[model samples]
Target chain A: MEMITSAQNSKVKNANKLKKKRDRDKTGQALIEGYHLIEEAYQSTVKIKQLFVVDVERLDEELMTYAEEVFEINLKVAESLSGTVTPQGFFAVIEKPVPETTQAKQVLLVDCIQDPGNLGTLIRTADAAGLDLIVLEKGTADPYQDKVLRASQGSVFHIPIITQELSEFIDHFEGNVYGTALENALPYQQIPSQDNFALLLGNEGEGVNADLLNKTTQNLTIPIYGKAESLNVAIAGSIVMYHLKG
Target chain B: MEMITSAQNSKVKNANKLKKKRDRDKTGQALIEGYHLIEEAYQSTVKIKQLFVVDVERLDEELMTYAEEVFEINLKVAESLSGTVTPQGFFAVIEKPVPETTQAKQVLLVDCIQDPGNLGTLIRTADAAGLDLIVLEKGTADPYQDKVLRASQGSVFHIPIITQELSEFIDHFEGNVYGTALENALPYQQIPSQDNFALLLGNEGEGVNADLLNKTTQNLTIPIYGKAESLNVAIAGSIVMYHLKG
Candidate 1:
């Protein structure tokens, strides 16, 4: 039942600060932009810090009743705080999700999927496939990024996504680790599988990290026959995820 | 070489007009933003109407030599003309590429791919697959869209892309059309010869249009052992492209 009238308000200032990845990481806060993203995040039960409604007159009472704290900003200030040009007039600052450190059942790991859209889509697909957890290595883009979050459409909220050292967790589980590579790899379908597994996706250019590759139990590829140097990294990852499903 | 200082200058106005699809379609010349895309258009021997450059003093001579008419704009104008924030400092008001009408040896017919990223990636993939032509039916996004252009990385310039009356072209080809679907279609790997083919990609939500599906010489589905609902459109197209290769 609070309204933040000034962009200079301490809450607005702190909310705006979450735009940077460093800030999000340091403070354990994530920024979800636009009406749809925030709605998805809400539906997924991400803990909210504060809500900023640009035009209070237009907001329905149903949405207003859900927020713990609400603030109103002029369109300009809302746009200033928003990353996208077409601001949705509403935004939220929410706490970062802490995924459970579970024993691997089935996992999709992204090495360095750089394209945010692709990365988010990959995560969404992984979640939709009923995979237990998603792991991101050191160089991968932040899964909490605004664009990635928006592209994910709130899967980031519910999905147990973790970023950790690859070597730290390499030998900790008892499942096969199948990574995609261009050469000396079997076709994805040809690789026989058991129930417990982890499928690794390499970076767009360099592919799976060398350390992880050396430890991988199986190496596989899509059996590409055309002239494409390689398929898009996200597409490759999605295919592997689909192929590896138990 | 003329420097356009005022945003209101007539040519500057025309150049700026290209920022939106309505303007682009109205003028028959589209704004190809970013250095790589302009480079792609220029390298392809396509005619350039007006080459808009910014920070001209910083450009290399190779790029400088390719422009027919050049104008200098500030970063703001360049940003306005570009759809993305990181303006490439160079944009081209170029004629839409029309590839030779030579009978297509193999064609790709796409139906209602709504995502620009997906459509652009498909176009780029089609080019990589050595496809002879690309056909976009109604409900397809503009191929000249900035996101598609960037995602395609200029492959559109080389590929013969057509957005036209689907029935007429499908009628003329008389080649076997393979439409992708969920079930009841032959596994892609079992398909016959590669030459004289048209591959149909449909909407992600709706699958192929019924009219086009009826017209398909055959219906095919990629063999999937996984539980994922469907492969990403670009990946699905690539998998089929790989399988259909002779």
Candidate 2:
């Protein structure tokens, strides 16, 4: 096994750059840390470009066989490539999967969600609700960001998430386009559940873009019976997604 | 207006100490930052022991009038007391509200939820869903922590959250005790929506504790139809809380 003892080693340096969205975009690859996430990626058949592990003997046999290239990295190199305070000692550089082109019957349209944790939890919730795809508006946080990935708990590997102009997507969407809003909207329960639909959730401070809300086939709201101004975007989105899926 | 130019001012130092859970517990006071949260505390009738602001002129007149002691703080003092990168220039040291003595009809029982964000969001969601109260088990994250307070978006002020033993509470409870579990649990929708119920949510990794699960009137689960292993605790809790409140 090749050993990467220096943080400045060419492969280690390149993998470190993949932490940024711009670098991930330019190279079509992203770095993921920890054994659980890497295992999820492997199980999902995402291409593993390279693997870095502190202990070669402890590496999962299947991952060992499947990795295109494996390097034994010291604590220093692992720390450089890790996003977390405590490096998990296992990291992988994997090719971002190509988005499936098929028109999804059930979709979650995320509109400019700025919080990475909320965005990631929404993705995970959508996956659990069996949504076919997640369409993120341009301003939404990058799904591959470390916080987002960790919050998604590897559901990012299980679900298809793509970035696109939400307005254009809604224009072409054939099924029920349910937009959540505080005003001029029916209670979410009043809307009949449908087999094919797109649930639109908006930014935390500002709601669904006005133009996009206008394009939605129906707008709905979960009634706030108490003094809270509103529900968190991820929480609101999850409830409606599950309701729609039913 | 009295000015506090130094971070070492006795009052400023004491307020800073309230940032830690142990100190907050000992003093029965917690420091909350940002304008919105402070306003919420004021509206909730929580006792404000002291108010710290960068500019007295910019402070809301009502908050200024209501605060027991108002101190004008400089940027250095503000930065030292703030939890976020950019300080909002408003801070308050508030006494924890006494738990309401009356029994709540709709309750949220949280068991060992370790994440501050999850715990906070649950509080916010319960408030929005019109749940009467939130009962936290011993191992759950401290609701007064900065991360929890911020994630809660001031909903902590809108609801009563008290820590109590789940087993004892369930034993004396009058209505249905719904424990969320993956095994031997009915689909959440299968249960009839009832006004008086206690919804139990557990840790992120572990489902409801086995002993607690056995004590519930009914164990329920939100269906997961995709490759994702489970729903996030807050998400699952919100869905059920809203359902039971319907």
Q: Which candidate number would show the highest lDDT if scored against the true structure? A: 2
- For candidate 1, give the DockQ: 0.22
Judge candidate 2 against the unseen true structure and give its global Cα lDDT, from 0 to 1: 0.91
Q: Which ten residues in a row have the lowest lDDT in candidate 1 chain A?
A: A222-231
**Docking model 1 quality class:** incorrect
What would the per-residue lDDT of candidate 2 be over residues A1-246, giving only the tens digit for each residue?
899899989999899899888999999999999988899999999999899999788898888889999999999888888889998899999999988878799999999999989988998998898889999998889999989998898999988888999999988988989999999999998877788999999999999999999998899999999999989999999989888876
Candidate 1: residue pairs that collide: A4-A71, A202-A207, A202-A208
* Predicted candidate 1 versus true structure: per-residue lDDT over B1-246, tens digit per residue: 677666677887787777677888787788788777777787787778877888787665866776677788877677667777677778888888766778897888889898888888887777766888999997788888778887787888878888876777888886788999886698775776567899999987788888877888889986544333455677678666645653
* DockQ per candidate, 2 decimals: 0.22, 0.85
Off by over 4 Å in 1: A54-67, A70-77, A181-196, A218-229, B1-96, B102-107, B112-115, B170-246
Could you give candidate 2's per-residue lDDT for residues B1-246 as a string of tens digits? 899999999999999898888998898899998988988899999999899999777898888889899999999999999999999889999998877767899999999999999999999999988888899899889999999999898999989989899999999989999999999999998888888999999988887889999999999999999989888899999988887876
- In model 2, which residue pairs have backbone atoms overlapping below 3 Å? none
Per-candidate TM-scores read 0.75, 0.98
lDDT against true structure, model 1:
0.76
